[model samples]
Target: MAAEAARQAFRGRFLHCLPEGGGGYRVEYLEDGVLVVEGARIAALAAAGAAELQGLDLASCIDLGGDLVVPGFVDTHVHAPQLDVMGSHGEQLLEWLERYTFPAEARFADEAFARVAMADFLDALLCQGTTSAMVYATSHHHATDALFAAAEARRLCLIAGKVLMDRNAPEALRDSAVGGIAESRELIERWHGRGRLAYAVTPRFSITSSPAQLAGAGQLLRDHPGVYLQTHLAENPQEVAAVRELFPEAAHYLDTYDAHGLCTERSVFAHCLHLEAAEIRRLAETGAAVAFCPSSNLFLGSGLFNWQAFAAAEVPVTIASDVGAGTDLSMLGTLVDAYKVCQLGGHALPPLEAFYAITLGNARALGLEARIGTLAPGSDADFLRLNPRDVPLLAGRVAACRDIAEEWFAYQILGDDRLVRETWVAGECRKRDGRLAVGN
Candidate 1:
């Protein structure tokens, strides 16, 4: 039976950064929350001017008391099983993936371990106001299944897949190309687009995956054009060297994936920090996106990514925490670190640009612009209510702000999980400090 629809609204002074204003917005005293059903995919958005909301009796209402209701964040790249491995230092890409990542991911063979870690990871994202993400699962198929089940129950938009690695990884964590492809196909049919769930065609990286595995991943991409492709790319010098060694016939680091059919509009390569000009052009040509993991880059001491180059080439870029290497789950902290990265590289990213990168911009890159990432009607009603005065430093900063843009900059510089007071997914108030803020 179809779910019964319900009307709901949140009345308060709300603020969300407009893409046109470049990370600023005009505050409005109004009501705008999600109109949903027990299982409706966001019936509509209710605000003063909408015709559909006219004279309709709301089922339940939440008074936000003038908190921000911007679109929820979209984290383009993260690892579900890497929750416990965050904050480890030194070792660059390949070595680190082997020394820390692979062994740790190997543990996900235990379904219980993956479940506990996934629960913590999802809760952290909710608390930090990230409603959607492209997450990575380890080689174990059950690990990916567990993540999908968790996201489905929570009604969060989560895309993930089992890592495709047939070589250069621990024996237990590796899978033959044939087995990997079969497992991925089965999972995609079962979970893709089930509620807010989607599947990604995840190859760990060119270094860890053999030619057969890369070929298999490419075939998967060709077979399922709607699913996303995610993997590491040009993240570190050593990893680049390894790619060259593995694919000596290929032109460059990006060429390995391109040689296979994996270079397409749905592909998202994390950390293109070290790339030649030609590679950027190829990325633009393929219409692929890059996930700029600033905190991870800094933490791993990977070289800085050239945003100017990305901009000049008109290549799409998304922001991600790249957790385990990235220090915090807060996109605000990642944005601040991104700003520092820009300053260090002799360029400055306007606070608005950084904000867009994590929100709407990221949505565009991930092919989710139509349904999420903005305040427009008909989009999924996922958002966060932020208290600019959530901290003493932020309180002072908010007091001095001349405009909303400056206030956003202040949050980018100082905001953390504490700044988020409420989180909503599809109009359901899923979390609030210690209580279930909204109920069905």
Candidate 2:
């Protein structure tokens, strides 16, 4: 890597997604481009030999030979405290949570353990080329604070909040309705809009949080505008049935959250695999986003996500790695699973569309498109240098590709963390040569 400087440039093949008319996206690719970074923002992006490159410090530019430079991935939903339990024996959603999720989250009550776990979690995310994510922390306020502090130290764009679960969970992992709301309020005041950190009022789910707790979470969102709301929705049939039994008066599972003013533009619901038509329309009406966590859904035997329905409704959708329940942390691997899930539902996912969903689409869902998720000038300088030929199988497959889209598809199908050569966050190299370069 070149020496760090206030003004620096990197030359590579660059690609980014642009929103098209009619709620679609188009890919913009530059064969030989120079990305100029000044401070923490992108100053300029131009062809290597274009006149715009004149007067620039071309001699100091670091050239990434034949590598692909694209915006870093933005994971819409992930759990920071579940790193230790990833790939645990797959069971249904409720059973898995009780068996594996709760115990793993219980350890976060220890501040020291939480700090170390949060560090490892962030390192894992950076290694997988994820620069921005909406993360879920355990119910412990101190642990949530530790996560925010670590992310602030690294200057990462991370959104997280303490879990709010007043019932249907072990005592060690539950918080009272009033207490949870108070802690969340404090976290939002301290972390929201603090540098690159933000807070999300997280309710574990309808099954875990009492009615009062859910209402309190909504009040928290009302009290603090721009803070995010994240929770589980209709992921499993059993879970859906449970929600129906829990809230008999509500029209549907989504209605429970909606009644409490939790269905705002900033809210993100994960694993909405079994939503009804009315629910879909309501999501569209409220501008709430859904996180399509394919890996977790598949691993937990949850129903398939109705991508076609959501797309038709024009409700925002973003891909996510719901880690722990999810099989891996790499978004590339997650995309592989996403493609398979879509295919299983007879809707094929295009390569460019998959890439777009992880980058600009996700940022747009989170309402952070202006700050991150693109190579557009003035956006944060967060990106990845990916080498499709990182492994022999991937290299051979890419070598036979006739176009950029084919090459990208091959990478998604065969690539993993090894494909990421470098990850840059805020113009600083956090991972280089497939290893973490920054201290966690």
Candidate 3:
């Protein structure tokens, strides 16, 4: 990759979704804006050709014409290895795991396969304008190591961990509780806090992990502060029932992880579709974040999540592809599914709110909003330059837009990876015109 200049500026139609005092997003769209980047941070933003950048070299300026520049999407949850079996269907959660998901993830035990998959995954992430993601890998430590190396090479802000599954999994895919914790510790030692890369202590879920391993995972968090804890939660009814059968002593599915001290601000629990009122209240009280996987839930025939109830309960929520089960990597696609999910729940998710959930909202869920999820001054220079008129349909839609609100809603309903004209990460342009940028 070509070295990024010490400082640079880009001129574009800028957009950032700041939180409103109530429950929605406050959208700021600048028809003509200059975004200044110094090192890896967003230095400043001013009107195009403003006095602030008067003496800067013109060679350092990236002009996006009429394209839209917004903060890069933050996918709070995705399975990096599961991208291989993304389109497979016809089974619910448990049956799906046995038939397709586990088999596909087991392939990551091969080092070469893991590297290739992670490389492609990161490329897919960048091409679609995802700059930061909290990802999951297979049980193999070396394979997880390979994923970290691929992400570090790309300078992507990634948080990932090796899956810890001790029982009820295929023998080839399982590891003992003691061994799994040891493997996770080794990985955390090597990769945690390295550049923009962070680590998550991932105990696959209660069905696959033993109590000993869960406690070990909790201890791992206490041992290492600021590291994250990620795992699946009440994604499906059968999964929740299995958790009940397994942990008969616990109060509910959420209690399985909460019993392990795994419910905190640093914890990310994916898919609480089966939660009751008490569980939602507990999530709000415990400060844990839920990764609402709308697409995956729809594909698996999991129950519709009550978005309004979660919001009313004040439980922190972020969006995810839950890829493989989710069927797509596009955050726009996730937003699309989210919109439909909310519609089914009789709650209308405005386009502005949907965009916020994927960008700043997700960042806030991870406690990283100050560093990312915005074009706010001093944040990372990670964002996407999108042509709202990239395709014929979008072009027509853009032409008909009465205002920015209409344009935003139309894009969420119609956009995909093709809408991403360029993806910029940490002051460097990584993808342009739906492909890797020249240097990348």
Q: What local lDDT does model 3 show for residue 153? A: 84
lDDT of 1 by residue, 352-383 (tens): 67777788889878878767777665677787
Instruction: Give the C-alpha miss distance for residue 327 in model 1, angstroms.
Output: 0.6
When summed lDDT is taken over every stretch of 10 residues in candidate 2, the lowest stretch is 51-60
TM-score-superior candidate, 2 or 3 = 2
Candidate 1 lDDT score at position 202: 95
> Which stretches of candidate 1 lie above 4 Å from their native place?
1-5, 17-61, 434-440
The lDDT per prediction is 0.80, 0.90, 0.87
- Predicted structure 3, TM vs. truth: 0.96
Q: On residues 279-300, what C-alpha lDDT tens digit does candidate 3 reach at each position?
A: 8888999888899999999999
Q: Which residue runs does candidate 2 get wrong by more than 4 Å?
A: 1-3, 20-24, 51-53
Arrange candidates, best TM-score first: 2, 3, 1
Q: How does candidate 2 fare on TM-score?
A: 0.97
